[model samples]
Target: MKAWQATPPFGFDALRLIDLPRPTPGPRQVLIKVQAAALNYRDLEMATGTYQGQPQQAFTLLSDGAGQVVEVGAAVTRFSPGERVIGCFWQGWEAGRLSDSAALPLGGPLDGMLSEYVLLDERGVVPCPAHLSMEEAATLPCAALTAWQALVVEGQLKAGDWVLLQGTGGVSLFAFQFALLHGARVIVSSSQDDRLKRLAKLGATGLINYRSTAIWHEQVMAITDGYGVDHVLEVGGPRSFTQSLQSLHPSGQVNVIGYLGGHQGEINPLLILQRNARVRGISVGPRQSFESMNHAIEASGLRPMIDSMHDWLKLPGALAHLQSGRHFGKVVLRITAD
Candidate 1:
């Protein structure tokens, strides 16, 4: 088997493709022939040794992957050979609230699916939505599930409600699709006017080029008739938190999911207090949530927007593409034949 590992002195340059003995499943585990994997901002953070907490000395490098189950342990009953499945971001988190064990994430502390074959506990995988290809399914475990947790499970989004998406990255784009799927209107902001136009074509109710309008929240307020949006997918972390709060309606919720813009900034508590805001920090999601989102995706026939696909050997190039910030949606690495 072939895998990409983050070697010592963590950075993209340290990523190495190496051969290893194929892993075998133990009790209640499954061995999947990984077909595709997707990139996330966290992947970059981990590669660069910037992810919070002690970075792993060595580990595989991707949390989102999809493939076919090629073998299952004797006790494994949840899956069978040939079933298309996506690995969960948090291997130990099955249904409810998280625990210490849930902190053992893929692509960091544990070996991930950036390999030809990967082993997982039966509980850590979910059947892929029938409507999506392996590349599309690979986008769900992290980015799409984070969006689902923010907009659906945590935000409690509903028809006619308004949503504010910070950018056109995987999570934000998934939020846009899920918001529209629920019949809600979306306001999307990006630095590029052309990208905003593309989002407009995808049913975004309002678009703001943050590069042109520094105070994009003002435009969001104007679009909502001064009422503000009902939910904000706050992916920009400290750099955009104040503006996100400013763009929310009274009692609106802000689901903090990423730190693409920067990690440090000052925020006034008064801003949150004034709106009686509900601020929730979102992890990707648990396995149960993934299953629920998969069902919704299947029912709605919602296909993930894939910005580009790279062959597995082009992992470095794919990582560079993700770092370039030019991709409008998920950037995938096709690992093997589906």
Candidate 2:
């Protein structure tokens, strides 16, 4: 088998696709023939030496992948050969609140799925929605699940509520789709006018190009009839946190999943108190939530938006593309020929 590993002195140039021995699964594990994987902004961070807590050892480098089970262990009853599945981001978190201690997340602290074949405990994977392909399924484990956790699970989003999205990244796009799924209205912001137009076509209720209007939160309030959005997918970290609070509908939830805006800026607690804000930092999600979201996806027939697809072997260039901030949706890697 072959795996992409980021050895010490980590950077894109340090990535090496190396050969490794394939191992049989343990008694409760399953072996999957990985078909596709998706690159997150975090993956780009890992490549550019910008991500925090960089791994010290070489490990398979992706937290999101989808494939078919080719073999199973003696006691692995949850899955069997030929069943399509996606790995969970938090392998040990099945449901409920997270404890102080949990299993290492994939791609950094643990071996990820950017390999020809990967082994996982039966509990660490979920069935791919029947309506999605391997590439689409690969985009879900992190970005999609994170949006579901923040919007539906935590915010308790309902019809007619308003949502504020930060950008055209995978998570924002998924949140857009899910908000539409629940009959909610969405207001999205971006620096690119062309991308905002594209989002408009995808049913964005209000659009703001932050480049033109720095005070975008006022637009959010104005769009919602001087009230504000019910939820804000705060992807801008500290730089946008203050505005996210301002754009809330008194007691609105702000799900902070920021990484793009480099973590430095002043956030006043007075804004939180004024808005009665409910801010929660999202950590992707657990396996049970993944399963529930899969059911909704399968039933709603919601397809993930892919900005581009690359061959798995061409990961360096793919990561570079993602780093360039040009992609409007998920950038997927086809690991094997379909």
Candidate 3:
């Protein structure tokens, strides 16, 4: 077996691949033959020692993966060998809270699925949608799940509502697809006009090239006939928070999911009062939400936007590409031979 491991402390250069013994399942545990894993921006933070709630050095390097069960423990009942599956980002939750016990999560505090095989409790694995390939299903556990939680759960977005998507990153792209699937008109913003055009072709109702029009909120207002958007998938850090508030109609909802732009900044407190908008910070989501979202995804036959796939031996190169921010969707690593 092979695994990607991070050396003591953390740094991008420190990530390396090495051979390890294959894992065996215990009671209620299943051993999976990992096929594909996707890279989140948080994976970069975990590599660089900057992520909040980062695990100790002994942990694995990725939190999202999908595979097929090759072995199951004696007491396992929900699953069996030969089932296709994906691991939940949060291992402790079967269907509830994001964090229940101090369990080691894959690729964080626990050994992740960056290897040929992995052992996880049955509760941590979900049946992968049969329609999706292993690579596409691998993109779901984190980025896609977060978008689903924000727009559907917390935002209470409904059919015919207007949604504001921040950029072309993993979460935003998933949000775009999910919003459109729910019958919402989506407005996507990107610094690149080309990307915005691509998003427009993908069913986005309106596109805002933020680099050209710095005040994207005004464009959002215009697109909605001055009513403003009903919900926002807030990916911007503090820099875009104020504009997100201004972009929403009174009593709208903003789900703050990421801060890739930069964290240190401030928002005008009066906007919340004046707009009567509700703002909530999201932490990806709980495992139960993941299950519900998976049901919707499977039924709708939604396919994840995969930017690229890398070989296991070139794992560092994959991380470097994500750091460059040159891709439009999820970057994945092929971990299994089959």
Model 2 TM-score relative to the real fold: 0.98
Q: Which residue runs does candidate 1 get wrong by more than 4 Å? A: none
Candidate of highest TM-score: 2
Comparison by lDDT, 1 against 3, better one: 1
The 10-residue segment with the lowest total lDDT in model 3:
95-104
Q: What's each prediction's clash count?
A: 0, 0, 0
Model 1 per-residue lDDT tens digits across residues 7-30? 888887898998889988998999
User: CA lDDT of 317 in candidate 1?
Assistant: 85
lDDT of 3: 0.87
- The TM-score-based order of candidates, best leading, equals 2, 1, 3
Residue lDDT tens for model 3, 116-178: 888999988899988999999999988998899899987777899999999899999999999
